[model samples]
Target: MVGARFFNFILFFAGLAVAFNVKTIPLNADHYVKVLVLFWLFSTMYHHLRVLHKTGNTTVDYGISYSLSFGIFAGPLGLFIFETIYRFTVYFNKKRTGTDDPEEFSDTFYNIGAFVLTYSAAYYLYNLLRPVFELFPFGYWILIFLLVCITSLLIDLLLIIVFLLTSDIKTVREAVDFIKSRSILDMGKTAFTNGLLLLFLREGEWGALFALFFLNYLVSRSFYSKSQSIKNKIERDKFEQMAYTDFLTGANNRAFMDKRMAELDETGEYIGIVVADIDNFKHINDTYNHSVGDQVIRHFAKTLKSYINGNDNLFRSGGEEFTLFLRNRNYRQCLDLVERIRRGIEESAVEAEYGPGTASISYTSSFGLYFYRIHHKVSMEKGYIQADQLLLTSKQHGRNRITALDGSNKQGNMPVSIPKQKLVP
Candidate 1:
């Protein structure tokens, strides 16, 4: 941190020295026109400059491109005014959005210092290389512009490296990685375009210059649009998943079951609707506690869910109650599935703490399965009602058992339980 603050002071002093000289202001019509053009360009592109997000709270805005052009075209004094105003406006905008939380606004100081130093360096470089253009006097301007932009970019990267090395990062590797994370392609592209912009401005071709800027804006806007679209889609999917999920057991909730059932078609394919509840759940809650009862519910749901396949959906529709929807399954298939789930629940144990003592709570569940094909004349609501009634029969006959009914027959089947189940109400 000390190193970074020291570096900021040095950069600020260098920028101040360049600002005091004030040798690059406009003195003629053509020079004033050039400055006006740069101002126009900056105003148009300020809001759209590509901002690259970094790991920390730091971001690298491509505003430096404008600063480089502004400095070389308008000189040091103009560069100083432009950077100060732009960065202050950015800081206030952050304030409007409730995000103006920097350490005594050090980031603003650092940004102003770093950018001013970079732009000032570019301006001086142009001064040093002015002799080369005079020597060639035959179209060596483009080369000089390219050299200036590339050198400015290197200086920008170097300053950032110094800042990162002393910032809150833990290691040299992490500091270097911050520099590496910048887009090399973007760097090359910006430099190349700045070269073209310089040539156009130097040659005093206003029409071509504006056209090039328009093209750049169009490309940036296109990328931003596509990126926002993808981001919005991901957020929508996340919301939908959360809406349909039960928070306790990570199973589909009652809302999701209603949606899936609503979309089903009334056809010949058998649909299995199983409504199961933990046997003596209130007893468990009373014996241990609600938290322990919750564990028992989760254990039962997990055991039942393990037997469900991709074609089925299991839901925690209520406390200590779960529902399953099995598609394209016959009567025997549905019965066998219910048997496996019941046995799974019978074998599983829920671990919980009871009055400061740990205990393994063994429990069981009762299921009522209504296996049938829906008739257009009868709504599927009847299926759930029949299954619920069958659940009551299982609880009445005994717990730890399944009572199934095949409802597509001429004569409706009464309660049918697994013969091997022992009575344990």
Candidate 2:
């Protein structure tokens, strides 16, 4: 990525140098100073309005900067000087704060080169269209202004895409998507503002030009604040999700399951709990090391996940143990789902390599299902306890069997074992 960015910088600078030599536009000292001051103010405002998203970097400053360069009639040299000062200021500020990452330097150089090339291209095109601007009606001039804005934006996007392609930050698709997702209204506003600024300059309306600059600053600041608020909310949501997710198996953790159970309890709907444990998990760890054991756990979790219906949720309660919460399901439906999951696990194998050879190891899981009607008012804790007891019974009888709480029994103490069948080839 660094190399790519460097190559882009070289290309931009070379093109810019060529444009400057082709037709040098004599810069007015007064206009250059005024434009530089306006550019500085807009750049500062742009930084203040910057939004840092979780996915990547984004700023509204580019639009404002480009607009100022084009509107002020700053020659290529003047624009280059303006960008250089801006880049230097940024670098010095970062250096003072001890936040000068290596990438910042590369980015600063890339921006400087990109801005010079972009403005030079726009200026050259605007000059070429000057004859048409005078020959055609006012409406044609508007079209020409829009063409200039679009051309500059395209150049900016091309540079950005090139930078992204070289970096590990984002894929080409993602970069294009991000650009496409940009607010069209914002782009239109920027383009309109640039055209207005150019008109003010042509008419020698100094007061209106400065007024518009400040107004744009205020608008950009508002956008920045709103974007920051949205970014914060998204980050908070991401953190919350991370907290509730099991890192090892990518399933909801026990805490999330408990929270979900509370929500389900309030719905007054029938709920079923199926607690599953890998049979002889410790033996796998002993024979093939913990890495293979972890692989087995993840495989089993994925297999169990496949059997879960839309109305059900899966959770990895802890090591070698998982739970499924079925909503709006009766005893029969829940049993059938659990039995299917059990059969799937019994037939599936996890392939792993040992020292020099690979082996496919088949495994089984024991399930304990406890179902409660809507009116039973059974707490999640109580359900868990009943399911756990049944699971213990299944393990006591044999490792590869299911023990289900018999709903017909009034005492709530009976668990029935499902007939164990041999694995089919």
Candidate 3:
């Protein structure tokens, strides 16, 4: 609440300063009306095209309207009025939809403060450089324009950093890094367009001004359309990823394994399948709780991931069960990898919370590995069944063991399990 009040106070004073600057400048009511109409049109168009996040947060709309205000020699007063009207319009629109959040109001003030400060600094620098600019040839005006644009961009970036700090949105280093990653080329393009419009406005060519306004409107529409398309693509990718990702262990889910199996079959590649199960997982769940059991599962999954190399995929097949797909690896290699993972799991301890304290719990797992060539008339399901049978054999032999089919049995017509190797520590 104190921070909110501080932001409001800054906005009040900033508004006063802008209002005072307007009073000092010669009143051109007619020109102000003309600029206001043009600004309002662009603002309205951009407003409707703006994208609103599902969370009700809105992305920052492009500052084409503000750029035009500066281009037309609209003093600080004109820009302030334009911003005020725009804010009120947005506020009322959101109010009608019952989405007018208090934070939105604060954001409006924040944006207004940013604009006034940036434009004020740019106006001051423009005046300071005008004489020096006149001494140079005509094309040198671009330099003055570039410098003023840089000043505005720098001030805007500084205010964004300050906002990040005050609102606790990010640390100073993070804010700086964010600004550094932004595209300066985009900023320069906007400034160059504004500079061109400024030149036309100075020459009193109303036709060119209106034409440029239309062109800017079209450009904004194009950008809005492209941004919407990109946003949709990102959303679709996120959904696809979620569909195939395990919620508990962060491994690929069974569905993903099925898809990969189909793809591997099409390529007719020899693949090794390994099935692993945490020994006595139900005992862990009953001794502690499901939460502790989940922790153990996640820890075990992390250990399993450590053993994966190129072209090796791990999946959470179901509760307490995991599957690994090893491509182009023979039975011996797969057996060695799974044995290493089983040893790693045994050595790993998970911190599980219980009631008032946390306790480190050591756990063990059993693995079953089977290797098969795709073109040898063996199905992926048959391979998984063979591995599952070996996994059961390990569990029966006493948990924490590996039961893998020998390489010589790879071409067998039926499922075959070799002798189990107990790895109890």
Candidate 4:
């Protein structure tokens, strides 16, 4: 609180000094109103169009270029009047629109004071540097104008950074990203536009000012719209990922499995539809709790995922049941992979809460496999149904075993092969 008061005092002191100096600029009423309206429009619109956010107290004003041009055109006293009046207007605009946040009210004074000081500094700096470059080409005029803009930007940034640190750096990393997080290209854009505005303002070119102001807004809106597009795309992709992923096990969910199955006939690759079910999952849940049951599910899913490749997909189709779609694998490969995954599950132990502490609980699983090439009379959906039926057969005969069937033999009466339950030993 003392630190905040200290900052307030410094800012208000600078603002008050500028406030007491009531000297005026030489522009007529018509020209004065034109410049003031341009400043107001640029300032207000830029706030809405801003794509970046402040890092703590370090606010990046994209309107700094406009503020610089206005400050230099008017003197310290005139700039001071605009800053105080304009910021309060911003506060009221937020309130009228029902978008006023508490921070907006609290920071109003800090904003008015600090912005007044920043613009006032630009006014003096530009005046001091103007005569030094009188002999150089018009390029030096651009250089001096840029220096004023940069100096004002730095001063405003420094004040905010100091205020934030006075509150403390325990909140941020030592590797604080200042510019990269706030794009330098964005600042360059505003600075370039503001420089041109200043050149036309001094030359009394109202027609050019009107044209440039319109063009500047168009360019600014174009950049802001592009940024919003990228941001929305990223958010959309993230939501889609969340939708297709199982929350508990991080495996693909039924939704993605269904979508992948719908697209499989086009590939014409050999496909194996396998269903794996946890052995006595209800018993595990009854013996411990749902938390332990979840751990077991996750461990089982992880083991299954470890066995699959890029051409394979694992889905948590149910609480205790998982489905695997393996591509480009024959009957032998499908049988071997299912057996290995089943054995892996049977041999693994998951650490779970037991009484007062934790214990390693070993578990097992059963699998059913249906191997076939796509474009056959047996569709992917039919293969999945057949595999699911075989899965029920594996569970009924005995748990912790695999039942295998070739898609070509689905109609024939071949005896189902059940692997010896590994837990029998």
Q: In model 2, where do residues sit more than 4 Å from their true spots?
A: 1-35, 51-63, 67-72, 77-81, 96-99, 103-118, 136-190, 373-377, 406-413, 421-425
Candidate 2 TM-score, C-alpha based: 0.76
lDDT of every model, 2 decimals: 0.72, 0.72, 0.71, 0.74
Quote the lDDT for 146 in model 4. 70
**Alpha-carbon RMSD to native, per candidate:** 5.3, 5.4, 5.1, 4.0
Q: Write the per-residue lDDT of candidate 2 for residues 1-425, one digit (tens) a residue.
A: 65666665785576458445645445577866876787676675566355443334322234444434352376676666777788778778878889665566666766667767766667667767767677667854565456555655665585566546655346668666656765656556656777787777667687898898888778878877787899899999999999999988999999898898777766666677888999999999998898788889999899988977787899998799999888776677777777888888888898877668877989999988888753444677678778888888889988687888745346764677774673211
| Winning candidate number (TM-score) | 4
Model 3: colliding residue pairs: none
lDDT of 1 at 56: 55
Candidate 3's clash total is 0
Q: Which stretches of candidate 4 lie over 4 Å from their true place?
A: 1-13, 52-65, 133-180, 265-269, 353-357, 374-378, 409-415, 418-425
- Per-candidate TM equals 0.77, 0.76, 0.74, 0.84
Task: List, residue by residue over 1-425, the lDDT tens digit for candidate 3.
Answer: 45654765586467658657666433478866776776666666667665443212323444443443352377666666776677777777877889676666766776566666567556666767777777778744566456645655665474554455456435668556545654566566666667776777567677888888778778878988898899899999999999999999899999998998777777766778889999999999999999999999998888888888868899999898999988877767776777778778887899888789998999999888777776546677777888888899878878788877753463553433333343322
**Steric clashes per prediction:** 0, 1, 0, 0
Candidate 1's error at 378, in angstroms? 3.5
Most accurate candidate by lDDT: 4
Arrange candidates by TM-score, descending: 4, 1, 2, 3
